[model samples]
Target: MAKKGDMLYAWTNDAEIKKHAELGGAVTGLWKFALESKAVDAVLVITKGTDLYDAQPVLISDPKELAKTAGSLHCGTLLMPKLIKNYFDGAANMKIGVTVKGCDAMAFYELAKRKQINLDNIIMIGVNCGGSVSPVRARKMITEKFGVDPDTVHKEEIDKGQFIIEYEGGHKGISMDELEEAGYGRRTNCRRCKMKVPRQADLACGNWGVIGDKAGKATFVEVCSEKGANLLEGAVKKGIIATEPANPKGLEIRGKVEGAMLKLGEKWRKKDFEGLGEGKDRLKKIMTETSRCIKCYSCILACPICYCVDCTTKNPAYVKPGELPPSFMFHLIRYAHIADSCVNCGQCEELCPAEIPNALFMHAQQVELEKMFGHVPGVNMELPLMAYVEEKQERARLKNTGSDMIYENVFNPVLKN
Candidate 1:
């Protein structure tokens, strides 16, 4: 039987699934097993859209339809938790199996904390993410940088610091660094993201470890919790998949990969934040950037953490309906409400018609709060700093308290600040 904290190399035993899946099809096999064995009522997945560049989230109840969601799409940028909470009745009624990237997993944790989702009825399968490309940007990159027709591309993969693409005749690969230098690559928020592995999820699966002959043919799976272990053991017992202990070298390699990605992320963070200047300069930069906003509310709609049914943004006193470039209060209200919970998913910035760097500013605010209160959002079930200090006395104490004093007085100081 699978055990919590067990790390193994696994693959789908089914030939068709192995052939169609990105890496050994272990994820697809597990989803199929969950549905056929009644472990879950439905599987939520992203399927290929009109073309290889498009991806659409779908809910599949039939095992036969699982194949359509086998492969990965780097251009698929939707966050699944909001859909589960807002559209699927918070998944309170049906058991579900869903795939998650780092952001999606964090969003799930935040939603669970707010009682928006029934975590008892959900199975989270975490996937490793380097980053995702915007569809429009990806098309342009292919056409100009790769000198290939974007429509002719059939497949894409990001590996070893390169963006690889495959078409009918052959394939081409470009250095991701080169692309970013040319003003094209992963989303800005993604480049600064440090969470490459979604360890918070039940099962963390990826191809980061396998090497040599097994390099592209197997998946490295980390059973993170009891629920994840049960799913793996059950699938194995039912002959849905095969597993073996992961190679020590594989695990070491995976650590090195994660370390390298984090280092690069740190570099990007410094570069991106440096432009904001400091003190009054930073405030001026923020004001200048947000002044372009046309009050489309696209950022609010795209945010996974925004759950208020009757939002203050809709109220005339706060944001004034039908006003163009609505007052700075509009953006300030959003920052204050979500700064503690923002997961840096980039949806807000990506969806903004004004092209404001919503995620960047929010993330900057979150970093400051993290320093002041030592609270990192979406990592666990803990309530945000604002949640605990709703009372006027608590707010007054917090305002007057020094960072070190706050760290020593209220919460665990041993935690990262």
Candidate 2:
């Protein structure tokens, strides 16, 4: 930890960074600062390819390359394990910088608890998540709406209750509010998210609702730890950037997003977080919804936490070639496996071409699991809550099987009936 009052700079996605002798544009100022900071041994940014001209998450040492990958810094979520593996593989001992979302940061926290990475030497820059889109679906939309040629599409977003798809050749917008919009940018995992802010992060940054000023300059920054504060402070003291209070509108937007999630949580509470119906009905729904799947294995690739040496789907011992759906059991088993650990990031649902809404399913189950266990998966690192530990203290915290609760007030009143 660098301690409080260290060098730091923060900004929204709209903030532009003037590079060495190059024209300035919207860039993740932190990445630019890291590039300028010769003290940093290496910089690892986990961002999307499309965001910065399809730049991958890798080491960017040269200033020019840093500029090219600057768009990646705006990404709200970057799966943690991939970046960690990159560091471990390189065997880099020097102070390194990496980006992660709230859930991904929590994933790192879990891994750190298990002694997976050395957190002392690393710089964790976090971003508050709005959501994410599957690259495959994004490409599909481009291809279907405006031809697959990269030159055709210029920009994309969900605007004014419509999907605004802009192109160099021509532009067209679809009313997402009207259409049966599924897949791609519509993140299913985000629907059940309760935490949008990065709690365990050293530094948190995002755009969410923060746009630049009339001068087109807005900065989104949150210092969660001593090192993060120091980084931003150093940047300001060194005259690299200016600081201002976050926009009040940003806080209002944050509240709305949080409120929406809380409402969803309340709905689940009313449902008792139980299965929709009996075993047959629930299984039938799963089968019918999953029937559309052709087993493209895209979800497995997008999933941040699904890591197995060799997946059973690929193993000859478990699966054979030319299997259309690969058995509903595989889907159910895989869902159950990741259910407890799922952070509700929504990548699986976003990536699935079949649009199965597995993310929502996970979210519903997550509520139930949380109610049952009184645990939030990766919130607290000091105490091991997700993993089962024998403790008399926890027994009281666990949900009772209805038989455990005493019927004192309600039951006595019902005797009159």
Candidate 3:
């Protein structure tokens, strides 16, 4: 039987699944098995809506419908965790199997810590993420940079430091560095994200290190939990999938690849944060940028860290309604409440109407908070010790009823009990 910490090169036993799925179909095979065996009530997946750029999330109830969710839609930048929280009763009522990127996995934990999600009922299968390009930006990059119509593109891959696309006639690739330098690569938040592999999930699957003959023909899966080990062993025993021990060489290579990604993340973080500057300088930049906010609450509604039925931002005691651009308090409230727990999912900035660097500012503060308080969000199930006592109870209460006023002691936080 498979066990936690085992790394295996895995692929599907089914010919059709093998033919269609990217990198051996291990992830798709696991989801299909879960659905067919009733291991999960549904598998939440992203599928094409209109074109390659139009990635929509769907809840697949039947194993037969799994084919539509097969393959990769790297352009589909949607987060799966919030959908579970908002639509599926936070997976509290039904067992859910989901494929998550680093951000989605991180968000899941954050929501779970906030008591917005019931994690025991959900199976999280994490995929390694380099980053994702915005659908619109991807289309534009294809047309203007790749010199091809977006519709004609059959597949897109970010491999070997290049953004490669297979079109109707032929495939073309351009160095990601070239594209990013020219301002047309991954989302700004993605560039700075260091969560390359979400070991927080039960299984962390990726095509990063299936070397030798298995290269490009299998997924490298690291069994991260007993749940993952059980699922993998079951699939192998049932002939739903096949697996072999991962190569030691492949493991070494994977480590190097992850190191490179982390270094890149730090580089971007330094650049982004340095530009924002210190204290009053950063505050001034934030205030100036937020002055354009129409207070549409797109960022608030979309932020995975935010899950209040009655939002404090809308509380009239703090924020005066009908004020154009709102007040600095509006933005401060968000920074105060979210900065401690922000997973930097990029949803806030992605959905912002004013194109504010919302994630950048939030992440910048999160780093500062991490240094000062030693609380890192979404890395584990542990409640942040800084807020683990009476504050956690009050925060949990405020999530539903909300305070008529912001808590006064938010700044002078008590040490964890």
Candidate 4:
């Protein structure tokens, strides 16, 4: 049986699953095993909607429906952690096996830090992510860059430094460098993301470096915790999946590939932030850009860190209600509350109605905060510089001392996903 930190090449024993799965069916097999063995009450995954660009999250309890959820969806932009918090009680009441990208995994830790979710009951199976594309931009790229009908494209992937697609009668690939040069690749936040692999999850799996006979038919999985070890060893014992030690050469290749991606991320971070100018110039740009906000609250809602049910912005004491282009205070509330912990998930920018680069501004602030305080937001359970404190402490402060200070700002009780 594999132990935590073990890296293996794994594949499904089920042929039917193999037919529909990508790289390998091991992830799908794991989900099936988890459900059938009562290890988890349900599995959460993404399913295709109308076309390759239409990705939606589905919660499944029946193992029979697991096959359709196999494979990656690079066009998918949904944040999985928030869905669990909003719809599934943060997996607090029920055990769940859910696939997660780096951002999703990090968000879970951040939420757990705030006591919004029960991390002990949730099983996170992380996937290595190069990045994700916006749906609208994806469709346009397929039509114009790939020279094919977007609807005809049935599958897509980022592989060997290229964005590839398989259409009805043909398949084509274009270098990511080329696409991004033309301003049509991954989102700005994704371009600068450094979380290529989520070691914080129970198990981190991807098709990064499976080689030789198993090249296209296996997943490279790194067991990250005791929970992952137990789950993987259980699946193998049950004959639901098979495994072999990872190839040393493949491991070397994987390191190089990951290093290249990291360097690229650094390159993009420099370009994106430097273009905004330094210090005061950058803050000026952010304020000027956010001035157009129609008080939609979309950014606040989309953020994974804004966990207060009675939002501080609506306190009416800090930010007056019914104010158009709400005061700079609206933006300040977000900056103060979320800047130290922003995960750079890109949801705010994606959902913004006014086209503000909210992720860019927030991430820039997070970077600056990281430099000042040496606090990396979501890599672990470590509390931020602005600590997350339980709410009962706040109530006791008011009751015993009769002080109505109301908030420490940083210690607000958070809802975990």
Residues 3-41 of candidate 2: C-alpha lDDT, one tens digit per residue: 442222233222334432111222245555656776366
Task: Indicate the residue-level lDDT of 188 in model 3.
Answer: 85
Alpha-carbon deviation at 158 in model 1, angstroms: 0.3
Q: For candidate 1, lDDT tens digit of each residue in 1-417?
A: 898999998888877787688778999999999999898999999999899778899999999888768989998788899899878888999999999999999889887876778999999999999999999899999999999999999999999889999987899999999999898989999998988999898999999988866788888899999999999999899898899999999999999999999998999988888877888998899999999998877898878778765576776656777877788899888988899888999999988888888888988888888888888888888998545443435445665764323323435445435
lDDT of 2: 0.55
**TM accuracy, model 3:** 0.93
Each prediction's total of clashing residue pairs, residues at least 3 apart in sequence or on different chains, is 0, 17, 0, 3
What is the full ranking by lDDT, best candidate first? 4, 3, 1, 2
Clashes of 3: 0
On residues 189-252, what C-alpha lDDT tens digit does candidate 4 reach at each position?
Answer: 9999999999989999998879999999899999999999999999999999899999999998
Q: Which candidate order results from sorting by TM-score in descending order?
A: 4, 3, 1, 2
**How much lDDT does each candidate structure score?**
0.87, 0.55, 0.88, 0.89
Q: Model 1 clash pairs?
A: none
Name the Cα RMSD for model 2.
Answer: 10.7
| Runs of candidate 1 exceeding 4 Å displacement | 387-417
How much does each candidate deviate from the true structure in C-alpha RMSD? 7.6, 10.7, 4.0, 4.1
Off by over 4 Å in 4: 392-417
lDDT of 3: 0.88
lDDT of 4: 0.89
Q: After superposing candidate 3 on the true structure, give the runs of residues whose Cα lies further than 4 Å from its correct spot.
A: 385-417
Q: Identify the runs in model 2 with alpha carbons over 4 angstroms from their true place.
A: 1-16, 19-27, 35-40, 46-55, 72-80, 86-94, 139-151, 158-163, 169-185, 208-215, 247-254, 257-280, 287-336, 347-361, 382-417
